[model samples]
Target chain A: MTPETVTLILDIAITISLVVGAVFTLVGSFGLLKLDDAMKRLHAPTKASTLGVGALLLASILGAFARDEPSLQEALIMAFLFVTAPISAQFICKVNLHRRSCMTPPEPSSDSTWATLDTADAGDAPAQHLTPEKG
Target chain B: MSFVDYAIYGAFGAVSLAQLLAMVRLILGPHTADRILALDTMTVNAIGLIVMLGISQGTQIYFEAALIVAMLGFVSTVAYCRFVLRGDIIE
Candidate 1:
């Protein structure tokens, strides 16, 4: 294909991708409005916004490169974003759970059963023994 | 000077509207955690908007500004969440 044709194709692809990205973002925003809880609201934005911005960034890079310019720096921003957004979301969810008295703890399961046992054992053994009371 | 430019502008407008709705949630949220989630969503929308602007204007600086915003948003969310949980922003 000719250079002009190639550039045109790239531009079209980028435009389509960007439009889709925006749609996902708008859905995420609506999710924040509709979801019943903080954690549920958290899921929509991360899942949608991360990919939405990722698509837009990719478009930027492609558009730049198609026009014979450098483009990877935009990709770098996206790279950092993908890595960090989830961790921040996790942090917020964890802290929110801690602050609210009404929050329910996760259901007891075999995976966390040991942790509950450890806590119980610590609490029950209130004796301050210097050397395990002459048993 | 083409359909693509119009498409880009349209995308930007949609995201801006999304951001505004997110702001409503931020302003009127019943709980602190709800507000924080809104803030996080707003930041993500802003980053997307900036990237779209950078594409339309053909400037790389917008990406840099977005990077800064993303970093700050992450730090502040973590700090505020810590404060919420432990009554302090730091240990």
Candidate 2:
């Protein structure tokens, strides 16, 4: 293939990736807006948005290669996002659980309560010292 | 403009629309968790926008901005969750 053909192919790939990324991002946000329940809404951003950004980053990487710069720093962003997306989702889930904002999760057969819901005895962990004293 | 140019423009419009939708959610969200989720989604969309900008301009400078936004967004989400869960971010 000629050099022009290769450049054309790369450009097509980058464009396709960009379009896909944008569509996913829009769908994710739309879900976030229209989902009936909070927990359901949580699924939209965490899953779809991550995939969207990942696609965009892939396009960025491809674009760099096409431009002859061949930089991989976009990979750093992708890796960070992939690692953190689920973690932040979990944290938000915990927040939802703590606030009782959504349907309560089913009880475990063995455990009396979920760890997040289980209140510790005062003796188990002292909390008195953490409170600020009023003058 | 070529097909690539049209695609780039379309992607920009779509991502910006996504950001606007997330913003509406942030304002109208019934629960704190919903708001937090909206903010998180918006952050992700912002990163998309930055990446798109970088792609269109063929520049590398936006990479750092995107990375920093990602880090800050994660940290802020965790902090918000902590505050909601225990009423304190540190403890």
Candidate 3:
């Protein structure tokens, strides 16, 4: 293919990627606003918004190449986001669980309480030992 | 303008709208978890905006900024959750 054809193809790819990313992002945030429950709200941004950002980053990478200045910096952001999105989501879930903001999980057959709700034993809570004595 | 420019502009508009929606959620969220989730979503949207800006400007300087924002956002989200869960972030 000619240079012009390759550039055209890359541009088209970038444009398509940008459009997809934007639409997914808007949908994700809209879901966040419209969902009636906290857990349901969590479902939207973590997955859909992450995918949206990934698509945008993909477009950035393609755009770099289109400009004949290819770089991989966008990949760093993408990888960090992919790795951390679920983790943050999990933390948010834990917060929801701890606060009892959503439906509680079914009881475990063996454990008496869910982990998030379990209180630390006095013997096991080192924080108790770390308190400064009052004068 | 070409279709590509239109697409770029449209992406900007859509992402900005998304950011606005996330902010509305932040303000209207009924629970603490919902507020934290909104903050997290906002950070992600901010990163998107930064990336889009980089794309439009054809610059790489914003990469570090986006990465830092992502890192701090995750850390802040986790810290907020931990604080709410255990009443302490470090414990």
lDDT of 2 by residue, A11-62 (tens): 9999889988988999999999988888899988899999999999999999
Q: TM-score of each model's B chain?
A: 0.94, 0.96, 0.95
Q: Record all residue pairs in model 3 with backbone atoms less than 3 Å apart, i.e. clashing.
A: none
Ordered from best to worst lDDT, the candidate numbers read 2, 3, 1
Q: RMSD for all candidates, in order, please.
A: 8.2, 5.0, 5.3
The CA lDDT at A18 in model 3 is: 96
Q: Whole-model lDDT, candidate 1?
A: 0.77
CAPRI grade of model 2? medium
Question: Which candidate achieves the best TM-score against the true structure?
Answer: 2
Better of 1 and 3 by lDDT: 3
Question: What would the per-residue lDDT of candidate 3 be over residues B1-91, giving only the tens digit for each residue?
Answer: 6677888899999999999999998888688888899999989989989998988988888888999999999999999887776667885
Fraction of the true interface contacts (Cα pairs closer than 8 Å across chains) found in each model: 0.63, 0.84, 0.79
> What is model 3's DockQ versus the real complex?
0.53
Q: Is the docking of candidate 3 incorrect, acceptable, medium or high quality?
A: medium
Clashing pairs in 1: none
TM-score for every candidate vs. truth?
0.85, 0.92, 0.92
Q: Please report, as a residue range, the 10-residue window in candidate 1 chain A with the lowest summed lDDT.
A: A126-135
Worst 10 residues of 1 chain B by lDDT: B82-91
Q: What is the DockQ of candidate 2?
A: 0.55
